[model samples]
Target: MRLGKTYRKGGFMNEKVKSGSRNVAIVGPYLSGKTTLLESLLFVTGAISRKGSVKDSNTVGDSAAESRDRHMSVEVSAASTEYNGIRFTFIDCPGSVEFAQETYNALMGVDAAIVVCEPIRERVLTLAPLFKFLDDWEIPHLVFVNKMDRANIHVLETLHALKAVSSRPLVAHQYPIMQGEQLTGFIDMVSEQAYQYHPGAPADPIPFPESLKEEEHIARAEMLEALANFDDHLLEELLEDIEPPQEEILKDLKMELGADLVVPVFFGVAEQDYGVRPLLEALLREAPEPEATAQRRLKNIKGDTALAQVLKTFYTPQGGKLSLVRVWRGKLTDGIVLNGIRTGGIYRLMGQQQQFVNEVDAGEIVALSRLEGIKTGDTISTEQQAAIKLPKAAQLEPVYALAITPEKRNDEVKLSAAITKLLEEDCSLAWEQHGDTHEVILWGQGEIHLQVTLDRLRRKYNLPMTTHLPQVPYKETIRKTVASVHGRYKHQSGGHGQFGDVFLDIKPLPRGTGFNFNETIVGGVVPKQYIPGVEMGVREFLTHGPLGFPMVDLAVTLTNGSYHNVDSSEQAFKQAARLAMQTGIPQAEPTLLEPILRVEVTTPSEFTSKVLQLLSGRRGQILGYEGRNDWQGWDNVSAYLPQAEMQNFIVELRSLTLGVGSFHWEYDHLQEVPEKLAERVIHSNGNGGNGNSK
Candidate 1:
């Protein structure tokens, strides 16, 4: 690749102008100044006249109502700008871990990403997951350490902390020059030149300072050494004590960074726009174009076909449904049919506002209105019959859940439609009507994540909801066996009389054995036709046991009964059977059983002890703990915990792990609830009224 001709006075030029475009995503941990970096980039590129502050909530990126109210990004926001002649589309992705699904989804289509972060040493571990994702997918990325004005540690020390979490090598491209406690300038390692910063304007060249020459030389040598690992020519020059040309070094940086082999680090105070121009310059010169990224993903790209991938789905109060898509291959025009769905309208999105456009070219990210059945991660193409192979981002598994109901009973019907839209907007959200508990549960990455989604439901869909802790699906079962329980029913009327008598034997079955019924009516003591009624009545009675929960792991048998041939009927027999169970279950020693789940919590090894203590406090049985596969310095702690104990587990886990921990769990088995807790649950569930006993 030729690196000399790519640079221009105003902006860097592209080797191939497929659409004269480059797409990049800005991502990092929560409160890392990603939005500020985005604002600076837009302002420096002349896309916006003035910079916007996060507190003001007037920024172009975070335009959603929920985002404004929370003062954070809730979804991916896309904006387009042009530096010189090259068009650049920037996607400002959510930094919160809960909304990482949005970032991952958008990363699939972007050419490269700028990982923004702060200089806190302790919080650097939060970037580990993001780094792992970029490396796993081979997506080119560079890290920008923001909030440099407030940095307390040396830049090199901060880089050391960041290197611990990344699999790729860290290459520092710029070194900050500090005066007392403030960052005033930076040295460009590639050019071997120093520049002084002036607020609201570009940096100006200054003579190389004598005091910092040794530090600058050491930093530059380290950068060269990192790049030399992948370039034989560069390594030869370094070994021979020959300084390589600036162009050759630039080529090495571009090549290695684009191949996902090295991460080039930059320093800045994004709130003041320092280092933003140089970062943009590096992106234009080094970041891969859409064609290269597309080739890397699709593998077998037909240049003539119209291929687009939906990165996000939205429902507008006025526009109905809108899908944010990246046109990867060919042109997308209004009224074009893609994947058998007619495009209702084509639009270029600027935050929450839409600018109507006739069509959009390949490499451009835009929204398509009213495209039904198309969802996030879906690939759309002009040829309906073609099976286009495209890379898809992995979705996040929900870690927290809420049992939700409509605020007003009359909005129940509207709630379903609103939930459908909510799922469309956020792929990480999921809902289910639990069969056992008969409650509607909404699941997401964390508490705030689900809360933001709920807020959106009320704001955008006009469907308000209430939430509470989900009820555990508890069951009742007999502990002992009881036999020869007699029940008789007799009713008389003026014309006829009703009479029935029955004797039943109730017994306990092994755990997990569901209800069963049997009959041993020799010589037809009870009429054969009436036997079905007795069984039906017994099954119905078991649904609501003496403890007010469905009974399981027990069986009942009709051993004997007397019937009058003239008065016996199925109705009389059914009534008599119910009466028998009403008296027999209590005598058999019924008890409450609660569900247990096998939980595997993955967290930093440093927090394993705390996690174990947390679990033990919640009556959790520790099975084991080991280093998580494919994750460095992390452990997956496995345990069996009662569902009741898991209700608030996620909230506490995050509090202990700096909001970086997560867990997965599934139903393992059912165990009898301890007497004390069982009594509390029984009272809480209103089962005490039904004769719950120790």
Candidate 2:
């Protein structure tokens, strides 16, 4: 249960030799110390000479062009450091909820989390989702109270604020000692050591300030109480009014953390080095190693045994496809047959760099090169090991949808490939050929999600793509029954003559039965040879009726007709059928039908009244409203509205919530078109080359 120590004598010195590393995620709310904390980790571990400032835009993980422009992280970035001989690959993830799924995916195979938070109460609100994710997934995590150097900051007060929302115990392992307006240094509750810093000087152990002894004692006692809750032995000692030993406290912390029962909270100023050494020492000693992290279950290629799981994937020009994997059960080496193919080029990932390794063992992350035809979720195993797979990620349903098209006429293929690459990079993105609208639509979390994706398309693949609200798939149908009519066509020539005759009865069927055909012709008047021909003609005419849309839910019956014995033909019958449809359709009161969608919107409850009013104005029928957990003033509202009325609903909802609300929709049913609404739709469609209705 000891921390990551190679060997130790005469005080605790970090061991420098190890064959592997740990992957940790530095995550937090927007503008928090997430990126800065990662930079500090790299600097403290000597991975970089000095941490590059986000303001300077020279940081390793903040390499995206947009990140530099905004001086913040827009996505996840990876950087590695070797401290105490244990390699730690740190992933800095975005703080915005719009990008939460990105962070979740990056944690697929990481060992633990360092949830960074600021002192401002408002800024600390978003940490709930991140912490909830860890608890729900049973992933071990630690809270890092960042930005100690800021003026008017209270570390303990911030901790209490976060504690109110957190479900698990917030155990403070490092207590920062404040002196007037400066962060003097920190006190280690576990090791019972006091370390002080002088602005630009190195950290050194010093005597505990007697003036703050009372507060430090109370803080340490609280830490002990938190430990007792998670440890049975400590609880027993606490019941007997006896203090637990330091080794017992440290041991319990490691065990509870490895079991995902407790998260050790650390305090420090990421910009300065104050209070960081203790945090680093504790992490090296307490954080779970790769062996303790969740192992991805995947099957062997032969369906016999498995030794590996594909945790992440990267697109590489040279390697074609790179799968960053964690070997969990058995060994993997170059030329070893995996998934039935001869596996080759086993290597370890060092940041953006890769190095050839003889073999990859259980409990480490490695980037396998040239795994041709292997996908991101595949499992590779030894011929004798059993296959296992990890739980599938929760699919993120997109509330907003937009149709995408290439900017240039000739770039259609390039645009399609670019979107496919984007989908591969972010599975949270839902894309498909929208059958009703026949538009290539991309659905995402929000406006920003789509905007960022478009940016990446241009930046990564040199494809210019644009998005727009998709058009509703409206249909045309008949409203009233039309009388039967006879249609005949004939042509006379010198040698042969063509003639055909038929009578068609067009009637309105039910709303959704679509097109139906029946034949009830009397004997000899119309032969059976031209019945299908008449139906085929009716089918072609049904494609575009008076309103210029395919006709549906209509019953067409062949009642009576006469045909020449030698001149009846399919073409002649088709012409006769067309004439019958054109003559009888207008009389049948053909009308356009529009699709309706059942929509459920979730927004802060404070905006509920306004949202209800807005929906009502759009002809949305409100079903009900109910409060949702953790959304504060937010409520979930359900309603049904015409699809045409919802083209800009996503945009309107965002405006109502100030960019906090979201919604989802499904096909409800088609509703009869209102006269006024139908006029507008018809006018727009007529000018857009959809053909005009008489």
Candidate 3:
């Protein structure tokens, strides 16, 4: 009853079956007992002793500092287990939308998934994003209705709600046969057996539910009917009024589930461990095997065919970057160079420790050492086999940006190195210098992501950083063209008098034409030697126009100018040109231009109105909406919004739809920021200089 070891307990003494390899992803809504379920699985398989709880901070996974503090999974953690001769690599992915990208990454390279859902209808809404990810990838996945004893909703209604969000048919393979307020046990419709947990211990076994026979028969028949739809022979046998054999039904189930045609739902109370045994057996019997998947998706490289793909990446304190991968094909032996790339040490990971294993065969999740070049989605192929690309990992666009710099001027080199290492681990983050603002900016999935990278920089890399809101690379341009303006500068300090004059016209060029300068003074009133100086001065002033932002989309024409015999130096001419730029530019009535973005959002149709309201609140224009047939009750909505308004759209979009809707945006065009916002931005950027410069 104490989650006893498998072989020692008086459970079913099943024969040792030759179970193959399978990849299982444990995903669920926030605090829906996903980590607890994974811990229980580890315990039942003898991978660990007595499941560790999040409150205790001793769970097999959820070891990150943030995860422990929040008492929730913040990162995806994977571990392999062998139960009943089947090898399954289980990934416990985070449920929070703040870390939903991490959950999406875990879904890749997995054969099937166990989506944990809470019983409360609103509480269960958190699982919508996971369902959306499953839909996008078309990955075979099942739903596990967790917290049965504490759940307020009925099991049948919960299943119906779950089915409403799924594109594929969601059939119940297990149902609860409750006794009063207590869930006495569950009926495994697939196996046609009822299991009653030991009443005294709640985890101990007892006699099956006695009164659910008639109900179990109907549920079992329906489950079989669902399976029969996938197999022609099974359908024929069912039509002939014959009950299909257990073996045949299981085969059909595995085939249909692997093909992602149907998703089977099951009820469970993970806290009491009431429904774990049947789920374990179901995984062993019906979950897809690595060989079947490998055979279906193998490629021949040079010679040896190796089936492998990186599922996750961990930056360890001692071992550095450890790329966790599941080997699906040929054997990987020590000192054996499979491919010319990264011919080095092969390691196995157990939590934070890396165990040196001599060799790892197919179905093993091992970590490779010094894999500096290996990335999260890289396929580790053998020399003989052609590399087969795994399903693409999610590419998250960075939403929040911050200007990062070394706290100390001298630590710039170290800061650069730290940023590079951070980027290597998280390819989703982007960094570049804003050429217009001359400020370096770092971009990440959200504000927390950037903050975490900064934390890691100080903690792991010893690089203290300074953070500030990134400078917007604003531009200034004219609304209308202006004719020429004659300007001159004459000054006498004593030794030499400065005297120069120029005739200039500022005209509007096509958008994005940049700044262009021309000289039409054929008579050489302004000498050719000083002509270059005038152009130089105009170009320099364009960097910070009257509005203190870059000036563009304008043409400066030097039609005529006067020169002094002795004091008419290039410097004087340049000053004359700078004066000309100040006088002629104002006539154009330049306005500040801000960056606009084209945004695309995807959300369930039920939340369409909410998403529209969010867009409208952000001053976004709704372009159009298109619904994909494959995405159940979801529509892809596109819109155009100002980039400044999209700083936190990722977070807002998630919050608007109960952390279900998502969006992507990129720079589209430039629009004039209102005078109020432009003034605020200019003041914040230290642009409080004189109104006119000459």
Candidate 4:
């Protein structure tokens, strides 16, 4: 196959001559050279005049200002290039686990993915979650072991480490030829052909290396055996010791890879352009086309009208809203109305750059301008379609939170609109006004995730923020029952002065019962109208207990009360009840109740003990731990942890588990704060004064 010539900006193929397109994602762990791989791919394809480095911060991917400042990708960057007459659009996804939602959303629309990673054994575990996602979605993918020039381990050793994490069988498509410590070339496992790497040019075909004959045979046999699991003819040929034709082997690889049954592994140094051309060739030949992907993704929905799903939403400073969508079924033209909203324009994206296009064919990812109300992971279609919706990637739950306040008080009015747009850009981020604390809490996957969000808020919306760990919504509950507490309120300066008297019984209820109020006033001792005032006063006081938090799990009863005919109004009775509660609660042994969460932490088995220790250090009560279902060599640990200890838990957990550890938590029940910690909390909250503290 002949490679296509340089594709200039805005020089897209006409619809009449267009052969086909492939949407592929470049994904892996941070610092694994995914962006560098993307730069090499675009450079070798002649889409760009020169290759840009991530260190220089000029790569086609990671072009956002935030990414440049951090020297890492904060979001998914889409770039289009043509290679071998096939229009290829590569989505460069963030490698940080914090930004994984960006990768997951982009993966939903792609035909195939290239899982890029390093050859380090210790870092192989970082690919576990990514591989699981690809397999779970049945999205065909192959592995590209990057940075081979710096490898400290043998190629077979790297493959062995990778296979432990991936559920699918890994087939070595090529074996690297190393000279001293440097990678000189690779031998194709299928064809048994050798190629020498050359800078700035295609690889030169060479004779098979006789020194590697035995090693190559072993690796080739392993690849054939893995493929034979799904092919009876190949199994028979292998059993009979017959050499299969190169075309037949390639066909088997293509069939098995497209079915998500096997993962073809290749090795190369992306920065030097070694082994990239062969990788591209494999994709062009073996990767599933858009039509096959479309049939698998949209099998349940039948439609001829244009069907597209918003993979990512962007709020460009200049262009306004750009909804990157994958066209699934029909053609999309400029100004097409989808889901009752008319598109402002259509363009293909090259990182931050946009090239205006009049129309886009199905199976292509292009940005639709000014799509209001459309969100990430939303399936959109023409109005004539039968209201079809495509399944999107699940929104990841937030595991970290911060309380944010605008630097300028006047910006509060604009906060809601800005955050709405922010959430549209990243559905994984969540914000809420805490009902109890009344603080604006921003939630996300981790600290870096929220920091990037804050940076975006400052740069895009001019809403600079001050952030801190969010306050735990604590509650105070009585530990003992107090009966027959009497109180009186009398005020006199002139006629019709306020005067009232009340007797109350307060008792502790079971945990989680909340506030309960009742009255057993007999013989009209307290007027019916005044009884309601008494209950209201009790509730008002409960909002801020003596411990400076909302009170719960207690019952207050108005047994008897007296009111003056003219001076004893409802207001007078309310004040009397407040006096009674203020006098009685102190004697009832009020204790601080902190919210506990049922947390299930998932980590690689090797780190399970460390995770248990981490939980125990945070006053967490471990329930048990067991192997994670369907996840080889991973453990799921369940525990009950106080919400106060969870502010920095994700950061620590990731640090302990090489940035792959994750957990899910939900509110459990309220438990008493430890005695020493309770003192510190009360002191921080103004020593049991009127207001709560974060």
User: Highest TM-score, which number?
Assistant: 4
- Per-residue lDDT tens digits for candidate 1, residues 631-682, read 9899999999998887678889988998788998999888999998888778
What is every candidate's alpha-carbon RMSD to the true fold? 2.7, 4.7, 4.4, 3.6
Error of 4 at 649 (Å): 0.7
Task: Note the Cα lDDT for every prediction shown.
Answer: 0.86, 0.72, 0.73, 0.90
Model 1 TM-score on a 0 to 1 scale: 0.95
The TM-scores of all predictions, comma-separated, are: 0.95, 0.84, 0.89, 0.96
Candidate 4: which pairs clash? none
Least accurate 10 contiguous residues by lDDT in model 1: 685-694
- Assess the local accuracy of residue 645 in candidate 2 as a C-alpha lDDT between 0 and 100: 76
Model 4 C-alpha lDDT per residue in residues 187-258, reported as the tens digit of each score: 888767688887887777678889889888888898999999999998999999998877678789888898
**If candidate 1 were superposed on the true structure by all CA atoms, what would the RMSD be?**
2.7
Q: Worst 10-residue stretch by lDDT in candidate 3?
A: 1-10
**Any idea how many clashes model 2 has?**
14
Give the worst 10-residue stretch by lDDT in candidate 4. 7-16
Global lDDT of model 4: 0.90
Candidate 2 local accuracy as lDDT? 0.72
Residue-wise C-alpha lDDT for candidate 3, range 102-121, written one tens digit per residue: 77766766778998887788
Query: What's the count of clashing pairs in each model shown?
Result: 0, 14, 10, 0
Candidates ranked by lDDT, best first?
4, 1, 3, 2
